[model samples]
Target: MTSRDAKTYEEAVEIVLRTLVKAERIKPTQYARRLVMKEMNPSREARSVSAGLLYSVLQKRGLLDEVIEDVLEITDDVTELDTWVRNAARIAVNEVVFEDGDPDEVADVLHGLVRRLANPGAAAIVKAFTLDLKDYEPPEPEDELDRLKWEYYHPRWLIERWMEMFGDPDEVVALLEANNRRPPLTIRVNTLKVDPEELAERLQRKYRVTVEPGRFLDEILKIPEGLPIGEMPEWEEGLFVIQDEAAALASAVLNPKPGEVVVDLCAAPGGKTTHMAQLMGGEGKIVAIDVDEVRMERLREIAERMGVLDCIETHLMDGREAPEKLGREFADAVLVDPPCSADGTIPKNPERRWRITPDELERLPKFQYELLKAGAEMVKPGGRLLYSTCSMFPEEDEEVVRRFLDEHPEFELLEVKVGDQGFDMPEACRLFPHRHETCGFFIALMGRTG
Candidate 1:
């Protein structure tokens, strides 16, 4: 709780900014938001003010770098300082450039932050802290790629990949720009607990929750704005699960029926696993295998909360061994929701871009391939093996599927009925961030021909 006195906005800003650095930057705003809720004086107004500043800086980080170039001092080899200094500077500059505060006061606060957190030299560098707001200007990049790179807030290599995928210059820029927007609040109803329409009515009547039926799936709903879902009584009662429309579609495409044995190979934090259980009307068994025990706990919790605990069993081990452990060709369906570069989720998980390197992206395909192959091995003859990733890359999606198809002659691409509710994708379909207003996702539903 905040002290009896309302915390100053500056104090709140510092607390949030510092926590962003402490928690690490992949999802800086989310990390910092949690920290403020837990540690900062519980002042709703103050927290919002701080959080507002924090999110702006994170979302427009590239633009901020371009606009506030004069503020940072870099050597020949390094154009950026370490994370602590850079983060504090970003917070400082965000307040100075964007916030409605006195420039000098903002600079003073920032200088103090740097001096305390970094070193004297760092604070001294920006000590003057004077700005002619009108006179300040962003530097122009020499080439087209350089210009788009900083402007869209994506790395040059990633942008190049998009350019290749999109082909058109304008379309590529539009795609990256769309990723910066806040993602929609899409949720899937736990049909095992309550029908979607019934749940929507209950929510509307009781809490006046604004619930719109999903564009495609009757079991899904779009909640325009929501309080923390976990806090909702209906959520505790397991009425719905918060899932992206694209991810929910993956489970739907798998379409597991009641009494069938299903397997989710990469099932930690199992949104799709529980969704499959719901699709089964809580009658079938699902072997949910994941390497991370801690994450699987959440999966278990979701299953238990959704009243489908009897249908799902979670195992703490490598999913690759499912064929051995679960028996060969034992599953009527297998879902491989492997961890890829996760580039498609940049809108929802903004910090992903900052954390991923070109080298790192190159290494994901082999791991994804292994997971997909494992899912295929466990699929019964004519059973579906649904391979999905929150990644838009060909290497992780199309290329991997192509390679798998070539090696396993018996398994062929299965038409997936997804997109705008119930359209068939000829082979595999991509859910583009810009086109679909969902995370960038690629799903390939392959089947054993027998």
Candidate 2:
């Protein structure tokens, strides 16, 4: 489709739906990335908004199902609607049911867009769907899973797994809602160039945005609003790096000192790798390893940009076998941030939930446990091993750690102190969105006591 001005919110909704349709046809997870890459003069903020809206809509599938039920009353064969038509209806319903946008206006704009798109068959579908918009009310959520499905916009199976582990259904529901909102924009300042607090003061003066120090990363700046990091002067000079608050905590937990050898297994997109390098004051050896060549390239670029060149090394290899490649007891510290179901990241990528299943959930703990075992082998005696995942599921978090400790007596869990972040995990620290005001994450600090 050609680019057109979205003069009204409806037109904007149409554009978003069309994009999601295109993205779904290609690959669901890569949809937003593909769109952002394709835009010639993309406004990062606008794209972020579109992506957020699309994710929010997809996460609330139960609510969308209700919209479909209402539409079925006006017309049969809703199944015959094309991709764009279905997406348009979803967006309209999302605005009305989820975002609390005006129902009548949403319906009118949805109708207008379908007509303009000239898909007469789809327009008929849109018209039929819009007929009883005034009377449409989403059904109240029934159980804990349903509450999470509506509240956090997560799939039911995910909620079930979390509820089984957390035990408190309400807390799980609250965490899900927090994930659906746009996460705060956080950056880790380069202490090599400036102090984080000092930089925050300078940035606020220039951009008219407030900046605060992040809880864990002393160098992290929490910018409530400002230019995209790429456009900021600090970023161009490698004065700071954009990272999530939970992710920044990984390096702090590792707390690698200068002149030590640190290994990061599954380290791509290099957030923790670079953070570890920074924590070491760029004086230590950091071997950043990942299996994906494409991501390794990204790791290389980030390492270069962050100016941690002398201390950082990139390795493209299967992380499961990384210990064999590096030999046993090779590093002073090891950070294992393995691949996961990414359920905790649903707020960032709503389409991800639809891609996961119970079987997939069952398989993750084994993989994570194996990786942790492999990572443990790479740390020297008395050295630290920090295991982390951006997942709140017990199978991926505490259970895996507990099982690992049971199987391997050589390593012991280290208690983490964050001065009121939350009560410490017996074998790990868990950060939930509702409680920690960060992504739902888990970090286990372990030392090779043997």
Candidate 3:
């Protein structure tokens, strides 16, 4: 986190590539953003560009890594090399293939990047692959999913699963590629603080923020490129919060009423919880719970910033404890946006592409089931429970909701409607990245019919 850590673009890439390797070693519960912050205290100006590189490189690391291994296989063994060396090779290969620059200059810069940051022994290995990386190509796999996994930079198991569900390899490929693209930065206007139209007018006419009404909701705004969102005066005044459109829809579906009791079981950094506060006109009680105390504190901060502190109560307890601690049938409405494999929003946070394994992520569905069931238990008869995940995997989405319905016959999937664009299930819907133009997400609204 010193001035020497990330003073230039190549240096920044080096630091991130090194951290990327380290991030893979850490637990899935940890985030790479924190690792970057700790490793390099990049100044605001530096971070704008470097953070983009760090994320872009990491998000594409899966494909870049495949290419790197291919190059390593040509001359040496990847496993025999130091972890940092492999990461460096991936970054250099990513630059060679994807970066729009003078190819030779890019290669020269990478050589210098490795020489500066790598150990003497590792530098030789990285230098040996400099030009050879440009010509490296992956060996073809006969298996359809294996081919898609190599081409699209996704886990093979996930590709196979999606292919089986869709019955079309081409369709699954589109979804996988969509996750690799950089999604538009979107935000929801804080209606409690400012009028959406007026806020848009001010942002557009004055601050030059080009915002359009979102596809699903008028309150949400799609902020275009070329503007720093955090620097906007509206953001400082808490007139809006950066959130994905799918998550905004989930909160919109919950639709808490004024003075009603609501619980956001997996709420952290308070996106939906605060949005619920806005929907309730800052009049309802919302208990926001998350296991991470730091994020829970940020949730409180966001609530206060959005001028909705009076409505929300933050709790630093495990989401599993919400039903027991808050008492069963306590809330009029509940939202359990539980943690999943994060398949839906990878375009925005691309590091997820390489940071998780299929086996490592298998536990997501079981925990998602537990949280949804807990949220269901917390809803009173006639009240609603909305179970959502930023993932499109059937096991983590519809199947969990389906099982919950079977086990708790008292609850039935509520008829949640969207335009014909959404894949309508009997009681749930899956918003796909390719089809919906939103992060891959699933939501099932259930009512305690008993």
Candidate 4:
């Protein structure tokens, strides 16, 4: 808990290693980044460094273990090392294997740093490992899942499910690697003030930043490393809202018109809700409902921040049960971005893979279908209901749509042109990492016929 400047790369690595160990135990995945952010109090440079190191080490664990084995010469039982020591070895190995650093040089650096930061036994282990650094080779996979395990840096079970869905091994590897890399920061330019092209030009001139106009969402600007958009001049003036390209596409697909009453069933953090308000031209009512009180408050705050206050109304109620509270056929349109496995968002939440299970997958579609049915009932006759999820799994995407359509004969699927996002599936449209540069997602637009 003592604060000291990390003077060497080795000391920095030790700090990251210690933080990673503690994060793994305390928060696991979703909360891990927040924990690291809290502990490191990292400058931007340090954030990039620690994140890059953690991912590289995790991705190339096999090669890392070899480096550790070679360095520590005494291979009695490294598995018995305390979590901190194990993590340090992982960090050292990652540096040697992935960074292409000299194994001997890295070993020496790690040994000295461990001696200072860790106890004598830990220092001895690092010293012994360093002395034998040249005797190891990268481990080879013994099976398909093992091969995928190293290739994707994911668990074998998750890869197995992906293989089943994708049916192509090479494509699965590509998908997994894409998920591991840092996703681009995409923001939707608030067209109410400035067009996307003009915003992009201004950003480049002011911050030495570059933004590319997205294909699907005309307002989406792909910003490459600058000041956080929240602090930018454009943001302060309500000229833009930070949103992902895939998420921006959702509002475009919904295509709400002015004077329409739209309900965002699971709106929270207000990304899609605000976008829906923009689509409605900020003229009509948008009842943004979320079950969590905190998220509902956040939705209201974001709406106020983005200057979409005229149209948005916040409500705290579960979408599945809220139709009874609001009455049936109350809105002209309903946008349901339901909770799912979030498999498509692995690039942003790598720890989600560890948290998911077969049972959860089985149960999620049923929950989603119920929400879709409930949300659909809230749509007036001839109104549109858009169901979406940031999940690529068919059960949560196509199957859910198909079942809802089967049960509710009053609604029919509407063909939506997502502007080169991906192929339109039978009951829905899906975006994949291999095809779309955005997060893997699925959307189905349905119109109430009754």
**lDDT (Cα, tens digit) per residue for candidate 1, span 1-450:** 234322466576677667667666433356356655665454556554665566567665655555546544433322365665566666656666655546666666666767787777776554453343324445678798888876767777788888887788888877888887766568888876677888888877876668888765788887665434534788888888778888888988888999999999999788999889988988879999999877798789888999988888878888777777777888899999998888888887765766567775679888888888888888889898889888877777888888888899999887765652111335787788888778888888888987
Residue lDDT tens for model 2, 27-60: 4444344453455235554555655666667676
Instruction: Identify the runs in model 1 with alpha carbons over 4 angstroms from their true place.
Output: 1-15, 25-32, 38-52, 62-86, 97-102, 108-136, 201-209, 420-425
Q: Report lDDT (CA) for all predictions.
A: 0.74, 0.74, 0.75, 0.74
* All models, RMSD in angstroms: 4.4, 4.6, 4.7, 5.3
Which regions in candidate 3 have their CA more than 4 angstroms from the true location? Answer: 1-56, 70-86, 97-104, 111-125, 131-135, 141-147, 206-209, 360-362, 419-424
Give one clash count per candidate, in the order shown: 3, 0, 1, 7
- Measured on C-alpha atoms, candidate 2 has an lDDT of 0.74
Query: Model 1 Cα displacement at 7 (Å)?
Result: 6.0
Summarize candidate 4's per-residue lDDT along 370-448 as a digit string, tens digits: 8888898899998999999988887888888888888899889987666333233654677776678788888889999
| Model 3 error, position 218 (Å) | 1.3
- Candidate 3 matches the true fold with a TM-score of 0.83
Q: For model 4, where is the 10-residue window of minimal lDDT?
A: 1-10
Error of 4 at 332 (Å): 0.6
lDDT of 3 by residue, 1-450 (tens): 344533566556655665666666753312454565556665655555556676667666777766776756646545566776777777777677666444455555566666676666676666677666556555768786677776676777767667777888678878888887766668899988788898878878885667778899988887655345444677778899888888899989888999999999999979999999999998979988899987788788888889999888878888888777879988899999988877777777776766666774578888888888888888988899999888777778877887888899998877778622224365576788888788888888888875
Select the stronger candidate by TM-score from 2 and 3. Answer: 3
Checking candidate 2 for backbone clashes, the offending pairs are none
User: Between which residue pairs do clashes occur in model 3?
Assistant: 1-41
